[model samples]
Target: MKIILNGKEKEVADSTTLQLLLQAMQLHPEMVACELNLNIIKRNKYGSTQLGEGDCVEILQMIGGG
Candidate 1:
């Protein structure tokens, strides 16, 4: 399946959950925020949230420096 990840096109497995995708990308959920298809997905829901083809996903990493 193809989806737009952070404005770039990418292919992912069918029926991929947000949690799985994050793991595949080696991303730590605790340090990032995810928005799926224009909606912000709650961290607790990552395990259950399924990503579909053509979905637009935005992953923003949290950075703390002051």
Candidate 2:
């Protein structure tokens, strides 16, 4: 399956949930936000959210420096 991640095209397993994707990328869910195919996925639902083929994922990191 093919999906666009952070504006880059990549191949991923079908029915891949958001939680698994983050883990594979070494990304911590608590430190960033994810937009799944243009929809905002709540933190609580990350574990259940599934990513399908052609899905676009936009991950944004939260900055704390002042």
Candidate 3:
């Protein structure tokens, strides 16, 4: 299946959940914010949110500085 991640198209396995996608990308959900198809997904729902073909995801990380 193909999904749009961070504005780029990528192929991912079927039945991929937000949690699994984060793991595959080596990202920690606790340290970042995620938006699926322009809608924000709460951290508590990552495990239950299923990603599918044509879906779009935007992930942003929180950084502290200055």
| Number of the predicted model whose lDDT against the real structure is largest | 1
- Which scores better on lDDT, 1 or 2? 1
Point out the worst 10-residue segment of candidate 2 by lDDT: 57-66
- Model 2 — TM-score against the truth? 0.90
Say what the RMSD of model 2 is.
1.5
For candidate 3, the 10 contiguous residues with the lowest summed lDDT are 57-66
- lDDT scores in order: 0.95, 0.93, 0.94
Clashing pairs in 2: none
- lDDT of candidate 3 over 1-66, digit per residue (tens): 999999999999999999999999999888889999999999999999999889999999968878
User: Residue 10 of model 2: what lDDT?
Assistant: 91
lDDT of 2 by residue, 1-66 (tens): 999999999999998899999999999999989999899999999999988889999999967788
Q: Name the runs in model 3 displaced over 4 angstroms.
A: 64-66
The per-prediction tally of clashing pairs is 0, 0, 0
Indicate whether candidate 2 or candidate 3 has the larger TM-score: 3
Could you say which candidate leads in TM-score? 1
Off by over 4 Å in 2: 64-66
Q: Is candidate 1 or candidate 3 better by lDDT?
A: 1
